[model samples]
Target: MKKTPNFKMFMFLMVVFVNTSYSQDVVYSAIFKNVNKTAENLKHHLNTSGDTLYLESKFDLNRIEIIGTDGLKTFAINNITKDIRVPLNSLPMGDYTFAVVQTEGRDDTYIYTKTIVFKISRLLPIDMDISRGITPLNASIYLAGGTIPILDLAENKIITDFPAAMDLASMEDNKPVHLDYTSMESLVALQEKENLDAKHLRTKKIDNILERNKPAYSKAYNITDIRSGNQNIQSRADYRRNNLRPNGLPYD
Candidate 1:
């Protein structure tokens, strides 16, 4: 018996063919050195209050396009100069690829394109807490950013209903804590109390020593002399310190 043609397979093949064809037509050329340099010098500022993405470029931009990770265009601009500020509050929080095309020379002979990827994350205030365990703490936990969620794991299951913030008294004991989010993938638990105290004491000691020796450092560096209003007197003092003659003799 003759087999029937697969309609679903045929539709899938058609979709793939059209997508591949479209992608081939929109190929991105390698970024030119000048354009790449300009992009490297570009400064990006995210203004949360204004909900805008401020971009400052060194060179003239022919086009600026923001493309989602799914290959969909979200925003675009053309014939923009050194400064381009686009509102980004409407866009969802995720990774986005920015394509910048620049032109140079009177005839716009030199064309360059550069692509940069950036992530937009939701701003959430993270609260952390620590408790003492039965054993004396020997290690210290260092937290870099204050945005990771703290989790507790005991019997191979993750505890999510733990308190957002907790106050543990001195000499109190509790179980080890884990991180709920992948942002703290490298971290295992919070620092123990004894270790934390030791670190704080060391930091305090160093700060105190610095404070005590501050006068010596100031005397050795003497940067305040440069800020003095008398330029003529300062110049003469500098010349004398270098043993240069006051008769405008160029020091060899």
Candidate 2:
């Protein structure tokens, strides 16, 4: 296995644009915005405004830390690869800094870390849009909680039936384009308690222009079906229940 390189050698950042004039920062110590070789440090300038916050990396990203301006850690979550989940709705409107940590496979061996910056324009209190009559940027809207909000620059009111509050417009000469960073990769169940799926098909009604024009790219999906799950001991008693926690590796 290839070991991670030293972070000191790659500790500078250059600005990058994903699909717009301005993109969400990734400060990944590279000049080009698109680099795919896993051997090298990989990161993307992701500008998004969806509720399902995630990234485009070949690394096994496992943790996320939401930080404040004074370098105070507000929240930290391990097992982030389960879904690069960041609870955007629960947070109030403000600038937030993210520390996305990637580890070597399933272990605690650290590989690389990067910073992502975004600003939440307006938050409609808790369960009600008590102030929709007032607009922050004239294009502001309210969300009903549950969906993630990455970089909300939406001109229309936000859709409450969906899972993410993605930045869904590209209207201005300098406005950010839809970069498809808001990945709906079958990881999240769109139907939840707060969603209004039973009342109407508001979700299905959403028209993602990029999704429609995009060709069904010929791509194959693969993963280690069976992994030697986390365990310190491997006695004979453990093998009796070796279903998910197979004694050996996925492949010999």
Candidate 1: minimum summed lDDT over ten consecutive residues — where? Answer: 124-133
- Which tens-of-lDDT digit does each residue in 1-252 have in candidate 1? 121254335434644643464323211111112233435756665542223445666666555555554565533333345655453434454434455555443445645655444333222111111221112112112211122221111122212233345566555465567556864643433446567889999999999999988743222223356544433333444555666455877565
Q: All candidates: CA RMSD in angstroms?
A: 28.8, 32.9
lDDT at 227 for candidate 1? Answer: 49
- Say which candidate scores most in TM-score: 1
lDDT of 2: 0.36
- What does candidate 1 score on TM? 0.29
Model 1, runs deviating above 4 Å: 1-38, 48-50, 74-76, 106-110, 113-117, 122-252
Please, what is the TM-score per model?
Answer: 0.29, 0.28
